[model samples]
Target: MSQSKSLLANIGVQVVIAMIIGTAVGAFMGHSAAMFAPLGAIFINLIKMLVIPLVAVALISGAAGLGNSTNAGKVGFSTLAYFALTSALAVALALIMGEIFKPGVGIDVSSVEGMFSGEYASKGELPSFWATVTGMIPTNVFASLTNANILQILVFCLFFGLALSKQPKKNREPILQGVNTIVDAMVWMINCVMKIAPIGVFGLMAEAVGTFGFSALMVVFKLFLVFIAAILVFGFVIYPLLVQLFTKTSAKSFLVAMKKPQAVALSTASSMATLPVTMNTVENELGVRNATASFVLPLGATINMSGNAIYYGLVAVFFAQLFNIDLSMGAYVAIILTSTLGAVGQAGVPGPSFLVVAVLLAAGIPIEGLPLLFALDRIFDMIRTALNITGDAACAVIIDNIAIEASDLTESEVKQS
Candidate 1:
């Protein structure tokens, strides 16, 4: 009895309970559950408060501490290659699933009046691809931070950290220490916020269920199932195979080790929230080197978004189908490219799925379908976040293995010399 009671005290367990309670309350109370909206907002706000600082500090510190020029370049190039390849694969899988399932084929939008709230209807056209890429370079660093432009912040940090890496060790130590201190403080802050996560999740879920109700969910149910199926395939089948091929880690062990972090990710619906656990598990449990884990996972959290890539591709196709928009071959190519890049820059939080708006605009699909997507965002957020962090850990393992092989080769060469 005592053991069972203690187990129930765990935050992950509590969060699951909270989700159930929130869903029940929303179902029964309906729109009145929107009263809990503020609570959810406060929780999301707390997590958001930590995002910019945490991402900036983690990236700068990781890059600066990444060792010699050759190693840093190697790791950087390798990580980017892995991210791009996986993202492309993810988008391809989504497109395949979307075509096969045809989630929106039979839906009649004519009778579905006012299903969307028009919250995300675009006021202006989306920027061109070149324009979007150029916009990643921030004109005003402080303004970018204030606006929480993730790609802009990432671009600035990459340059800043590269510069810092070129400085003498004695000159860089103080700055690196300061940045590490900030990272520690941010992680500590996240831990503090996590104490209230159950309540926050409860409120968020309640608000979503209450305001949108089951009807909104039903409208997108087919797309939701298709999305979930894609995630399961990626997480269970694809990730495990990659891990085994790259690192010799068994799928069962990796999955078991990830259970805690995955649960937290599912509950909080934030990859950033799961970072600390991912780092710990990858290093201590999974045997990934600290250096590799530190550099790869933080960057992965910001940019390596397989789950987002899949979601974006499917959502774009779904909207296109619903509106009977016949996409040109050029549009399909654009969706693949834009969705992959968009996932690379997406924030690792609940609502960053909104980035799909940019993809929809680029594909010439109307943004009027956004509200329907938004209504079911939370449900999908949970699953995708779990996949995002899982991919991060897998990347860490693969990189760590490569680093070790390189070290061994260097050692053998030195001995032979």
Candidate 2:
């Protein structure tokens, strides 16, 4: 009885309860629920406030601590490989699940037609592939930070951090220490923001439900169901199995340890907000090495987003169905590739799924449907962010184990010599 009471007191539980209440109230009150919008907006803004500085500091600190260029290169290569492979698998799973479920089938397109506007329609044009690549390198660092351009910020941080890492310890120690202090302070801010999550979640839910109404929700209800199903299967089954296979880690223990961070991701719907918790859980509870956790988790927070990739694939198909656009096998392949690449490019950006606009354009889906899709983003964002951070933790564990095995082999060779 005592344990159950404690469990109910957890913030995650409170957020869930709040969501239910908000949904009920929104349904009952209708448009009047818009009054709650300010609360949710404030909460989201608070989370956004931390993104720029937090990402910059975390990336800089992680890269600067790499000891030397060789170790940094090896860790970088491993991290990118893990991220790409997992993201591709996630996109594949989404495409398969989407085909099986056909989430967008039977939706009355006329109901959502009014929701589409000229603003969103014009915003869907994607830059050419080469332009997208070059765009990541910022012309001005301050401009990137001010504009919250994540890819550009990531590029600048990589260069700056690598340079700092190469400097003498006596010269760089103070700078690294300063960056660490900033990270700690940003984490403190996240915790403080989290205390209000139940309220924030309630307001956000009420606004979405009230504004869209149950009828609007039902229009895309199947898509929502498919997304939830995918998240559950990926989070519970696939992730744990991978951990067990790669690192011989106990799946049950890993998931249990991950619960808190997962909850934070779900509530905030920001992987960046969940980074500190993910790092702490990986290092302290999961016993992943600090070196591996530090380098991998921060980079993962920025670049590893299997969940976003999955979302891209699923939603692209959903929109394709809604618009009666038939995608060939070749188009599906393009979606998987584009989504995987977009996930990497858009990492650390809040509303990471917004990057899916590019995927839709590439796949020849009408951009007008984007507004309707955005309506349901908040709910899906929560789950996808949870999956993302979980993948990050799993990658950390796998990489850490490989590093350990390699070190042991090297020591044995030395003894033989």
What TM-score does model 2 achieve against the real structure? 0.86
Model 1: colliding residue pairs: none
lDDT of 1 by residue, 189-239 (tens): 887887888899799778877887888668888999999999999988898
lDDT of all predictions, in order shown? 0.81, 0.81
TM-score of each: 0.86, 0.86
Residue-level lDDT of model 2, residues 164-244, one tens digit each, is 988988999899889889888887887788788889878877887788676655767888888888888888899899888
| Alpha-carbon shift of residue 85 in model 1 (angstroms) | 1.3
RMSD of 1: 3.1
Judged by whole-model lDDT over C-alpha atoms, candidate 1 comes out at 0.81
